[model samples]
Target: MVGEKRFRPDGRKAFREKEEFPMTETPLAARDRRATAAATARALGAALLVLLLTVAAAAAVSALTGCAAEEPTDDGDAAGVATSDADGAIVVASALCSEPYEQATSTNQIGFTVELLRLIGEKSGRGIQFTKAVNHKDAEQNITAGLPEDVAAKVAAGDAGLGASSITTADALEGVVFSDPYLHADFSVLTKMDTGYDDLASIQGDGIVVAVQGDPAIAAWVAENLPAAEVVTFDAGVDALMELSSERAQAAIVDEPRYLRYVQVKEPHLQAVETIASDKDYAFVVAAGNDELLATVNEALAALRADGSYDELCESWFGAAPERGTATRSAGEAVQDSTGA
Candidate 1:
């Protein structure tokens, strides 16, 4: 009895012997066992098919009905009805967190961003209340209410009315509304004039060093495009720019205005050889469907440009007037302006 072989309904041997001890007959040797195994395999295959179908169905449902994880906002707290024109002041959130920081967010409140908001507010006849960011990277999530779920609905649901600072109107933030471009982000590739590196391509060689602010964007760019080049990062754009020398880093990439305002004024020897991503637009963010307030802001921007205040402010801050033809153009407006149509 101890040595007698046993079998399960699944056609697997049920004997208590160690699997290595061996079986006198293969599981498929017996007719009944073979039939049972085939049936079991069929059943398992059917079950697996059903499971896959269920998972696919669930995925489809989620794709159709599920909203994306909320875009990173400045605040995590739930908001009330966001209104563009409430009796109280509208909250304009500002900040941009940098890399190489232990904190979750940082507040790099550039003065012009706030001042520009104030100007827009004054022009729009709305009382703008400034809300600083706990972290600079924290977008106006508090006001955005996480997008495509409808930004205006959330804004009208809460007091987080607008997002300012150097907020780029990225495609990822598609559902969110953006006003006409007030500023254009032209990242300049700068090098020491003495090096004779007159363009970005001059230093695209092995062992050539490039510097950038601690953001991964530029570092990743160098890694992908300039595989032979080495990249260095710094906490500030100045630190990165400082790396540029004939003996050291061959190039540095930073916001053009930043280099123009802070570095170029003092270090006249450095030159911007080329601009990168000049088409990037910096615009005010509002909730989608908040048309009146958005139009008001856009009109205010146009007025600012028309009255020469925009160029004046740019010159006062960045030391040069913005490229007028580029900034403030909406999508179709650029073409119209270009053709004079």
Candidate 2:
């Protein structure tokens, strides 16, 4: 019955009927299925390799960019947030004075106060941003009158952190704090080499014009001590020295380091005559109530002193370390001592 032949009634031709065979795949079809599977696996492998290579490239780029961003900047501070934000920055106000201590031409603020603030920032993990004050007028005014709208007032109002310059302690700054004295300076007389006015007595005579910085205390001292001399006040030491150099004033009275640095060496036409007042102490002024910031600054100063950075700064600026046994007085105490109160 599986393979039988059947005839039609008409009898044209007989047809053979075969049994049905079970379904079996052909060799060509099997080869096609295997080739398709292999091609899919190759495509999947290529996709995974491309994904891994992309991730590796992204990681390498991130590592290189991170290293470049974390490098130290030229200002000696790590490059990061802008200091103007004040979120983690210490904003300092300083008045330009003598060279090497505070230079006008320095891009890095290569002065004593600038370097000191940088060191303090480094120790405290804060960044230093420097602002220029209107000179020592604020300190002088704070000494004479109550705190007017000056740098000290700015510090009191939280507009700035510290006032840096040759700021001394004063009795009138009731809401301000003074740091420990960094430099103990003496007030001295500067005169031309041919003036022949050696001492306060010799310089005090009729028609004698003496130039001094616009500190009321210094002006008062000159007025009280040199009664016979007329005092001319200028807002800056450079201006006062210029007055003496041009023969407009007979003598100029300024701090010792300034005289030694600006006049003695830079301006060779001038010479220091004698030391007048020897008790003035230079320090930074901060807001009174900010004890935490004050403590941080004091700690930094102590570290610098202990590590000899203070001495190095002194030598670089003053050409020698400050004398031993210098009094570390407050602004109020220094003002009282200066005024003999």
Candidate topping lDDT: 2
RMSD of 2: 18.0
Local distance difference test scores for all models = 0.59, 0.65
Model 2 alpha-carbon drift over 4 Å, by segment: 1-87, 95-110, 132-149, 322-341
Worst 10 residues of 2 by lDDT: 327-336
Task: Name the lDDT value of residue 320 in candidate 1.
Answer: 65
Report the C-alpha lDDT of model 2 over 138-182, residue by residue, as the tens digit: 545652322223556556655567766666654355456888777
The number of clashing residue pairs in each candidate reads: 16, 3
Superposition-based RMSD of candidate 1 using all C-alpha atoms, in angstroms: 17.8
Q: Where does candidate 2 clash, by residue pair?
A: 101-112, 169-331, 170-331
TM-score for each predicted model, relative to the true structure:
0.55, 0.59
Stretches of candidate 1 above 4 Å error? 1-80, 83-87, 96-110, 135-159, 195-202, 214-225, 233-239, 242-248, 264-266, 324-341
TM-score of 2: 0.59
